[model samples]
Target: MKKITTPLKEKDIRALKAGEEVLLKGVIYTARDQAHKRLCDLIKKRRQLPFALKNQIIYYCGPTPAPPGKIIGSCGPTTSSRMDKFTIPLLKNGLKGMIGKGKRSAEIISAIKKYKAIYFLAPAGAGAYLSKFVKKKELISWPELGTEAIFRLEVEDFPLIVGIDIKGRSIYDKR
Candidate 1:
């Protein structure tokens, strides 16, 4: 297995083919629909974002509340398709990669090709297992959005797979 980090540079993610196991490290952001829409709004207004998007990875997850003495609560990838509308704009604004579960839309695939970006998927139904990898968590913005709030998570050896590539390839695509 290879070790990968984000915001993913073009060369690194482009080099990742489908059917590969990877362990991820570094700071990754967590967001869902509301957070994504907010981010797009911020970008459109040319306002500063809570975190840097360049060379960073955005994980689509809405984790459960952590119990006392825990970094996070059942942190797993959410359904990726829901974020399809927000993704293209982020990618256009220098967002390099994404992490989540399930399939995405054809428009997202086309954007991936246009931007030379990558999409990774963590295991489904494995939130409890994945939470162990998050070493720390910081809520960056939109706390009022509840679980959809943007968060910065520092992860170590977070397990994942290359679900989509720059060539508009996706592992979830039925052959």
Candidate 2:
């Protein structure tokens, strides 16, 4: 297993291979369907995003509300393929990595190669267990969207696997 820290550099991303286990530390952003749609809309209008995308990692999750005395609630990766339409644009804007579950579309795989980015997979149905990795969480935008709100999270040793590497190698490939 490789231990990595984010915001991941190009070298860090390139060194990773599909199916390799990784333990990631540092800040990652959380965004789900609604947040992705809004981000894409902003990009279409050529407007500023709430935060910069350069060398950043986005985790596709909408965590449940935290209970009292907890830093965050159940947090796990959501289906990544659902955000396929918006992903390429984010990649073009310098987003370097993503953490989510499931296979990606051909277009997204192409974009991953084009942008020299990587896709990571967190275990499915392990939300409660994964929440322990989140050290801190702060709402960044779209509070009205509730669970779908964008958040800035500080995570430590968050477990994942390289589902797709920058070379377009994918763990989910049938071959």
Query: What is each predicted model's overall lDDT from 0 to 1?
Result: 0.88, 0.94
lDDT of each residue in 115-137, candidate 1, tens digit only:
88888889998999999999999
User: Model 1 residue 1 lDDT?
Assistant: 79
TM-score for model 2?
A: 0.98
Tens-digit per-residue lDDT, 42-120, candidate 2: 9999999988999999999989899999999999899999999889889999999999999999989989999999999
**Steric overlap count per candidate:** 2, 0
Q: Pick the candidate with the highest lDDT.
A: 2
Clashing residue pairs, backbone N/CA/C < 3 A, model 2: none
